[model samples]
Structures are given as structure tokens and as C-alpha cells.
Target: MHTLFSSNILSPPPAPATQQNPFELLFNSAATSNSTASASNSSAHSSPIEYNLLTRRLQDERRATEDARHVEPTAVRRKGHPKLLLMGQRRSGKSSIQNVILQKMPPTETLYLESTNTVKTVSMQSFAQFEMTEVPSQLSIESPEIAYSEANFRELGTVIWVIDVQDDYLSSINSLVHTAGFLAENYPRVHFEVFIHKTDGLSEEYRYDAFREVRQRVQDELSDVGFGHREVAFHQTSIFDHSIYEAISKVVQRLLPQLPALEALLNRLCSTCGMQKAYLFDTASKIYIATDASPTFLKDYEVCSDYVDVIVDIKALYGWQQPAKKPAGGSDADDEGIGESVVTFERNGDTYIYAREITEHLSLICLMGKGSGIDKRVLIDYNVSLLQDAVVEVFKV
Candidate 1:
């Protein structure tokens, strides 16, 4: 049998020299692991690495701000966190989107979600830590002092404007246009994201039509206002399916400063390992942090995301728990909380899906085909271990 990835295939081409060259770091890490593999053959495997650099940095910043002044704790926390502002017209499904996606509330349960009367902020504890603030629809954009003063759009990373597709959405589009205008004049750096939400009940044809209509209206209106060049992203989402998750994944990725490096790394990993697709997912939130540059098909993303759900369910159902461990200081705060799962299925008869915990919050899910032969599994694992180490290195403060 022929090997899928020849030794020569692993050598990556020279990338522009950044201060921290990811390719150089990846190869060096892989070499070091290979050097130690034989010596540690009989030794117990060490605990998996935990990636909490972002969280730790935020905590440190919070502490620094607290020591310097006497400000509201909430305001201090908001200063450093990646802020996701959710806005829409009254009765639009903004709260439902947050409740279902971030809070893990069931789709049907969102029906009982009382309308958010005030600005509500929730801290998202994920690989990319952020705060999601939902603005009440009743708050009008015409009054900047009232609405703009409270939300502090200058600090926002993304503004997600939700529009209910099933309702009379013309007014919703108008509100989005006005909001975009306000942001354009004052907080130009904040990214605008529109969610045509609650489309599960619409027919397939209507769903597509509604998506196009909302997008076109927003574009035309924005252009009419002189903010024509402003970039605005649009997505059709529903709490009932994986669309919302996929949309949010794209949004969160925009907030990651290391996105280019992560994408470059995934591209190298896939090319070197003979893998079809690879996603660095924030497992706790089911949002992919990055993926290989290869064209992404909907079916592939759904399968990989669903596999994460399956792993989580199995762990919960089986009550899989790690052995208790305490550090020298007797504190459990430093636990790595690592896990892994792998399954090969016959999608096209030779496909394999592999999920390995990259950190306390991140997991790498890979889709491979015939190249992942039984004999070559060891080689593939070695390459993945290299990816794990390189990823940790990239996130280093």
C-alpha cells in the first residue's frame, strides 16, 4: 500500500518572515516531540495542554484597572473584553439568538423568553473570550445620547442586528439602515453583522428570497446614506438548525487577531497530513475558530459540527470524569481538562473523523479519506501533536 503523505510533502514553502514564524515554530516543535518520543515510549503520557492565554490576559487587565481607579466592576470588565452588540427592532429575535446560541437554551424554550427591556450583557467563556450585549429593540436610534451612551459602540467588535424574516420586515430593514448610519459616523471600526433570523418556518424558496431581500435592502439603503463603502456581513440564521452556529463562528473569527496565522497553520497541516478539512473549534461553544483554506461545503461543516455534539453527548451520558488532581498549592484552578474522540465512517467509504482536545476550550476536528490508512495512523497522530504544540505557541502572550 502506498503512503498518502510522502516525507517530502511535509516540508512547507517559505512564508514571509513574521517575528514569530508559524511554520518554523511548527517544524521545530514536531522535531522536538519526535526526538523525545523514543525516550518516553514506556513513560506515562503527560496531561494535555490548556489554552487560556486570552482569559488570563483579561483577568490581569481587570486587576490592573481595579488597582488604578474606582470604576464600576462591570464597566472595567467591559473595557478589555471583545464586545458583541446585538440590536434589532421590537419583536425581532435578537434575544432568542443569544439565548439559543450562547446560553444553550433549547430552540422551543426561546418562545418563552421575555422581551429584553434593558441592555443585557453576558460574559462568554470560550477559547476567544468575549461579552455579548443585547440591546432592547425599544431603544430608538434617533436618540443617540440615550442609546449610544449606554451601549458604548466604540468598544464593540461586532454589532449583530437581527431581523425577523417571517414578520413585516421592511421596518426592520429601515432600523438596520439607521443603526448602520449611526455606527458609521461614530464607531466606524465596529463590524456590522445582520442575521435574518427565525427562518425555519419559511419554505426553501422563501428562505432564499428573504435572505436576498434583506441583504439587498440594507445595501441599497446604506448606499443611499453615503456610507456605501462600509462593509456589512449578512447571514440567514435560525435557532432550529446549525446555520446560526456557523454564522456565529464566522463572527467570532473576525475578533481573533491571530486569524491569519491560524488559517495559515491549518492550511499547512491539511496539506502535509493528506487531510480533506481541519477545523480548530471552540468545543464548549461549538464555534469553529479557524479552518483550512480549502473550499468549505455545507455538508462537511454540518458533519464535523454534529460530531462534536455526539462526543459531548457520549461524555455526558457515560459520566466520563477525569481523576481528581490538586496542584502543589492544592488549587484545582490549573486543571487542563483535556479529552479526545475519533470515529471513522463510510461517507464515501473511506472517510475518517478525528477530534482531539487542543486545550481546555479548543478541539481540532479533522476529516480525512483513504489517505488515513490503518498503518499510517501513527504518522498522522504525530503531525497532529505538532499542530497542538504550534497552536499553543501562537496563542502565547
Candidate 2:
């Protein structure tokens, strides 16, 4: 006696009309027809089954995604990205360093820069393809919100401590000592660099003395703290001259994991091309990321670095503005137009400075002696082509 509704299914109940009913005879026989109703009920019942299958499929997919996430966790840091931290006491040229080096601001103009009361970071791919973070002078390692926490220190490649030479720097040295000791013990991978800054006002002899004094004090203090084995690099810097650029170039080189490869490639280029020296420069920052294995003379580096500026300046005036083509490889920022320049100038009739574009944001500047294959532009270009391809491979730009 049970009807279809007695089961768990949700199909609608049958209508009450029947063929035996007397009302069926009074109504038109054609109006009683419902021949397709069984097919309709079957299709309607199949919908819920299909929906259940779809729901199960979606759940399986979500679970698989979670498993994959667990198998390969998401990365917290980007590959090939390093951060350079600028830290020191107030008015120690930390902010000025960023302004002069990254913003192309004049050294004199930095005098008017307001004090940074909070941590600030300037991210640039054109500047060595890394981030430069400036820590407020008031913040210390003990500050709860200090940027040098263990988590952040793990991401840092180098920390440049700027000490104003003209000001009383003893307190600065003390702070640097404590900070360095802490970091050296905790973050052994991070490099410690000291910049004897604002030396534009000091005489040559005083500069040397100041540099020695700072080095000695740091070494002695670190040794007393039982970290005598720790390595710290010292550089004399002034925004008014090329010293800052040179120091920064060294810092950037240390951060590069492929520096040895780049240097070896440059050595090959220099030897095969009979060039005295070769520099791979970051176009925007005027910082040479790599150079030949040969000893680097400050004068030679200064000349080469200045040549980058000269080429860019001349191009700014006369270089054609063509749509910038995609670079071979690297994270150089996109530009509206490509600025290309090839410059050669003879110095004292002995050294020929040749510079040309290697990539959108990189330049290869070479110093060739007279008769060192400078006149044969075609051969040099071929060798440089190989170098360009190799550079792209090395940086995987």
C-alpha cells in the first residue's frame, strides 16, 4: 500500500485523476494525455545525482591543492633579490646617501633634506637590482620594531654603517660595535660594512687618520667581544666625489653571487680583446657591478664611471627615442624608449675608452691601449656580441 513518496526520493506525488474515474469520460479524452511525464521525472531526478558528483569533484580538487601547497611551500623571499641596509646615528649621511646615489640629487642639495623619523625604503632595479632600506637613527637593535630583527636580518645582504667624520663619531662607533656584535653572532651570512662618511671637509692626511682610527677601534672592540675573527670592510666616502660611487660599487659586488663568474668573463673579454680593463656598469646608478680581475685603480674606475654619465648626457640631448625592446634577461625596469650610445675617446694618446650598450640597463665600457684592437670595430663588436650573450646567460636576466 506504500506510495512512491514513502521512499527517501523527493519526486512529486502522482495526480489523483484515473482512467476509471467517471469525470474522465466527461472531460475530453485528449486532455488526459501525459505520455512524456515519466521521461521528465527521470531527467529531474538525475539533476541531483549530477550535482552531487560535481560537489565531490570540487572537494577533491580543493584537497589536492592543499596537498600541493604542503609539498612545496610558498617562498618568503624572492630569488636573486638582496637588500642593502643603511644604518647610523642621526645626520650621519644615511638619507643623503640614498638621495645622492639613487635620486641623482646634488650633494649640496642633500643639506636641505629633512631628517627621517621613520624607516624608509627605496626599491630600484636600475640600482644594482636590489632594495636599499634606510633605518631611522633613533631606532636601535633593542627597539621592538627595529628593522634588524632576526626575520629581516635573514634577508639582508649587507649593512652599511655610515659615520659622519666631521661630527663626534665615538657614540656612533659604540652603537655600531654593539649592533655589529649582535648581528655577527646571529646573522653570520650578512656582511658588515663601515662608511667613513662626509669626508669632503677633511684633508687627505686627516682622511687617512680617520679611516685608520675607525678601523682600529672597530677591530679592537670586536676582538674584545671575542668576535675578532669577524670580517668588516671599511671604505672612505664623500658625496662630493666619486668615492661614494666606488664604495657603493664594491658593496654591490659583494652582494652578487655571480661576481666570480662575471669577473672571469670580463678577464676573458679583456685578454682576447687586448683591453686594459673592462667594467660592467649598472646604467642608472653609475656603479660598476663587475670589473676585470686586474687590479682596479681608482683613477681608471673614476674615468670609466664618468664616461657612463657623459654618454647618458649626450644621448639625452641627441639619442633617438625608439620604443625600448625587451631586454634579453634581468629585472631592469621598463622604459618608454631605449637610449643607446657608443662612445670612444682617446686619453693622453695611450688609452682608448670604448663604451657601448650591453643591455637595456647595463653598459660595457672597455679601456684599450693604442693599437690594442680599438680600430677594428668589427672584430671587437663580434667578441662583444659573445660577451653580451654570455652575460645574459650568467645573469639569466
Candidate 3:
């Protein structure tokens, strides 16, 4: 029996300080006034010092405004939702099975191909209580290379191998088993569900025989690998059958308990936060960050809800100006390199910071002037601490 559980188990982190300080606002207002004065005196022949002072003051005022409006550090948690990866040759009724599981027609038709060219993700909201993400047909068993390379498959919770009993390939269960083996190796923890779909087209006797044969084949393969008979489960399902839905629901119920933490994190992040997207960054590589952009946010930000994390160094990538540094030992002759700015927050007696250049990627709308080189490593380290603090504080785990 599959157990269904709510993914929204984690609580949202504390809201960051939204309001700006009065002094900061006043300084900005004064800077604007100075800019106005400078512009008015532009026609008069102003000395180089006056002109330089005005320009520098204006730049400072702009930087201060940006800093004041900057967004506070926030971390998003990836909730464990029941992700089902469908596998099998093309035209195996895979899409039809997905439609039934989702209780709606598939967003698009499944296609037949020798190999998958790209990986696709579909989020079904019909099961709002439990999130469901479906792997696109392009990366199914028919396209082994694409399936193996797709990053989305790494996070799947279950592999639903859909087979068309009437198709010519139905006689051979080897392909299906091989796909299952691939999934088992890549995602060892994910469960397996073999659905002998298109049973509606088969006679009652033949359907039963096909189902039994496929089930036995899968079991034998599993037993050969030293895994017990209980490792895999088979279901004879058709789009027309209502009981198939029940079977799917039951499977979900059984798997929920094993992934409480992941489910809780996702639920909290999706429900309480104004932003529907969050990212996970790899500290060592300074790359491999993941984000799920809701449909609404996708238009503005070309991000998807799928676990697509792009690797990049925020400072070097964004071209933020480095802050100038004073000599460490008061040696006027020695010039120290500039340092990068990072956001910081404290949680559970631990301080964490996430250092990234303020850019469109992070929704930082302010403009920063170019300056000396800031230490990229320092900024990255601080930002990492900030992220850790946010996660620990918000999730309490």
C-alpha cells in the first residue's frame, strides 16, 4: 500500500526586513537634490573639482538607493513530491496512462523516437494535495541516451513503465526490464511500477496472459539481481478503468512516509512564500544550482519548475564592481584589493550569508557602479553561510 503525505511539512523562514531605514531614505533624497543643483549649474563653467564632486556624489547616491532596495537573503526548500518517471517504447500508451493518473488529458501527445533529444517536465496540479511531476515522453525507454542524460530523472520517486499490450513490442519484456534496471541504478531509492496499459484493446484472456507474463518476467529479472520479489510491483491498467486510479493513489500513500522531510520542505515553500521559485546551489563547483519557476514567474524569468540548476559564478558572471579596500597594516604605500559584498543572516546562533552580485537573476533591480576587483571567494563563502542560516532557521531542522 502506498501512503500519501502532504509535502508542505516545513514552515516558512522569517520574513526579511522589508522597510528601509529613514536615514537611508533621507540620504537618497539629499543626493537627488545635489544632482538637481549640479544640473542647474551645468551651463556655468564649473571647476574640475566641482564637476568631479558632483559626479561622485551622484554615483554614491545611486548606489545607496540600490543597497536600500536590495532584497534580503531567502532560501527555498525542494519538497519531496511523488515524482513518477514513465518509461517504455514510443506509442506504448504512456501519455494515455499519464492522462489517467493526472485525471486530465495530457498537455500534449507522446511521440515515437529512437532517442530522446531533450528532457521535459510536466506538473499536474489536479492532485494539489500531493504534487505530481511527470517526465516527458521524449526521454522514455525508447530514447535511452536522452533518458540517461536528463537531470530531471535523477529526482524521480517512481518509475512507471507503461506498456502497450497490443503493440508488436509487447511480446518482449526485456526492454522494459532493462529500462527498470537503468532507473534502479540511477535512482536506487525510487520505486518501480509496471503498468501493462492498453489492456482495453486485448481480449480478457489475452490481457490476463500478457499481464501475468510481463509480471513474471519482471519478477524473475529482479530475483536474478538478488532483490526480493517484493522489490517491484506490476499493475494491469487501462485508461478506461477507474480502479487503475485507485491503484495509483494507493501507491502514492505507501511512498509518502519515506520522504517526510522533502515533502514538508516543498509544501512550506510553495504555500507560504510569495515567490513560487527557489534554487539550490553547489558550493564546491560554484555551479549546479536548481530552481523551480512557477508558470507565472516563467514569463519574466526563463526558469522552469523542473530541477534545472545552471552552474555560474555570480560575481564574475554579473560583472559587479569590486569594493576598494584599505591597507591592512596602515601602510599607505600598499594597496589592498577590493572585496565583494554579500548578504548575511543569522539563525540558531549560526550566521549564514549568500554572496551574489545584484542582478536580474536574483531580481536585484538596482544599478551598481564599476569599481576595483572584490574577492569573489569571500563573497561566495559569506553567501553560503547566509543560505545555511536561512535554511536552519526557517525549517528548524
Candidate 4:
């Protein structure tokens, strides 16, 4: 991997000098996991370390306000987060989505846009385990260093190619298709996902049409290039709606190997609880990490997302209403955070929503049939305890 690095400006961190090094703890596990996967086919395979990223980060604010951030050509200060690169044309809202997801920047801030000129890496650990790097649109992928670096990585990366959904650019589509095809073919281990961005301002019908048009065209091009439809995934993402967060969750979930087990546990919970569906949602972003086996309708996600908002908003209002009970050295899980939440409201007279707190950062939302003849609350409460243990065991891996 050092052969691909001219400088350690954006390289992964080194080993721990002390036992308390958090960076080492975080990235060392990544390196260990990378070594475990052995390719069955004689395809190109390099170390599966997360350093060889193909994703983008938010441009440094100082640079966004002045000039684009400069990629510091210095030695590595610490081991880095797994990397994801943003590769796209001009004004594609790459920096905006990067900022919202990584920096927790408000979506409103992205309205005042500025062009970036250099590659920038930003630290992000709250969501996924990757410190994303954003390459400038002006940076040519034809660069030997980038191509060589990409060719050497072994981990399955997520490439979110941002597309300006509002624009009419045949040339951009041509460029996008060609680059996507080339990368998907060469980097079989990498996931190439297309984001039809900045569609929030459009009408719902128009947005769907726009996404469909772009998706079909991209798929057609990939088919012509001798690739299957499943080779690439397309998402309609925008900062204004929950779609972006949902799309990002899908991208991040691809990187999480523990998700399948979690989903399996969720499926068991759903079946055992006599519920129609169950969702394991991330509290910070309101994005579901896993769910039950039932086909997830858009209505389900939106409804559960709103249900989470209700839980959070109520907690914010009444969190101070209760007296204090503090824990010892560990963090407090109760006071402001939800210990339990239950509400049964009719949606379509016969359908209802049932939500409960699982962990501090995870929640379970179950859609139930009104006439199941079972005590759902009791069953769900009992299963939540088991689900909690399963969640712990899954992440412990």
C-alpha cells in the first residue's frame, strides 16, 4: 500500500504508541478484518484496509469560504478513518451531502454554495467508520496515483457519484457512464452508487421522473457496456428530505457485515411478536440499520421516521420533567434519553404504529395488524430484552 502513497497526507494511521490510542483501536480492527477475507477467484486483490478510499468529504469551511482546502502533504498524524471518495462533475452537491452527513452541518447551509479546488479529508465517526475524502472535480481520475491506489485496495468501498438531477448535460451523462462502467468493471469489490442529487426543490412527480430518466439512461449504458443491472445501485438523494439520510444508510449498511445478523434477529422478533414489521433505527440520524422481512414500503419508513421524531421531540420537551437518577462512571441512559416509549394509534382504522426504545441509539418500530388477538406490548417488551442482547452480540463482533 505504501507503493501507492507519495505522501501520508491522507494515509491510514500507524500502530498504537500507547494502549489508550483510540485511533489505533478503531483502525486496527479494520486492518484485522481486511486480512480475513480471501478471494476465491484470481481477481485483483490487495489488503482490505479502509485507507484506500474512493469517497469524498466536505470541503474545509475556510477553503469553501476562500479557496478549496489544500490536501496537506504531511506525514500521517494518526491512523485515519475508512475513506470514501466523492467523484463527480461540477456543482453536483457532493460537498453539501458530505457536510450534512459527516460534519452534521445543517442542510440549510448548503444553499450558499461555493466551488472547491483541492482534495480535502474530514473526520467523521458518529455515523459510519470512515473519514471521507473529497476530490475536486478538476482532479483527473486519470492521475496515476489515484488509479494505482484504487487498483491496490481490497475492501468493498462505496462510491457515491453525485449527479446534478436538474441539469441537461449529455456530455456529463456520457462521462458518468464511461467512468462508472470502467470503475465497476475494474473494481469488482467496490460498490458504485449513483445519487440523483438536489431534487428536493423539484415537485414530487417531477423528482420521480427525473430519477427514473437518469436511472434508466445509466442502466442502459451499463448494459451496453456488458454489465448487469445489479452491478450498480441508484438512489434519489437530496438534503431537504429524509431520502438522503435513508440513501446514506443503505450505502453505510453495505459496509457493515454485522447488519445481516441484526436483520435476522429483527426478523425473529417480528415473527415472535406477531407484528407485521420491525425496524432497528439509528437514533442520531433516524436511519434504520436493519428491519424485518416484510417488504419495506416507503410509507413504512416515512411513518416510522415521523414516529422517531415524535419520540425525540417529546423527550426533549419532558426530559426535564422527571427527577434525576445518575449512574456511576458510565454514561446516563435514562434522564433525557428514552428508556421506553409506547403509542397505539390507528392509521387506516385497522392499522396502527407501535414504537419502543431498544437501546440508547436504537429503536424498534413495529407495524401491527389491529386484530392479531395477541398482547403485542407484552410480547414486544419481552422480545426487546432479547433483541438488546442480540444487538450487543452483533456489534461485539
lDDT of 2 by residue, 1-397 (tens): 1111112211213222222211111111222122122222232223445433433332333334345445655423223356788999999999999988877899999989999998888876663456788999888866766654567775677889999999999999999999898888777667899999999899988889988998899889889998889889999999999999999999988766445546655766776677888899988888888887677888888888888878777655554353344442232324443233445554566567777677777888888866564456667777776677656544541
lDDT by residue (tens digit), candidate 1, 1-397: 1232223222333222333321111211233333333213211221111112222333333334334334433332224546788888877888888887778899899889888888888876665565788888878655553355645754567889999898898998887899899888976767899998888989998899889988898899999999989989998888888899888889987666556546655766776677899999877778898887788876788999999888877765564354334221111122454466678765565678888888766889999856676567787777777777667755652
TM-score of each model, in listed order: 0.75, 0.74, 0.39, 0.68
**CA shift at 303, candidate 2, in angstroms?**
1.8
Candidate 4 on 269-290: residue-level lDDT in tens? 6656566777877665676877
* Every candidate's lDDT: 0.69, 0.69, 0.42, 0.60
lDDT of 1 at 87: 88
TM-score of 1: 0.75
Q: Per-residue lDDT of 1-397 in model 3, one digit per residue for the tens? A: 0111122212233334432211112222445545544543441333345444534444454445455546422212113455666666666765565554454443233332233334444554221223344444445453655455545454455767767777765444666666666656665556887777777778978889988877776788766764544467777776564434534644553343212222222222322222233333222211112232232222222221111112223333443343323322111111243222333233422222222322112211101112211343343333333433333332222
lDDT, residue 204, candidate 3:
78
Candidate 2 vs 3: which has more TM-score: 2
lDDT for model 1 comes to 0.69
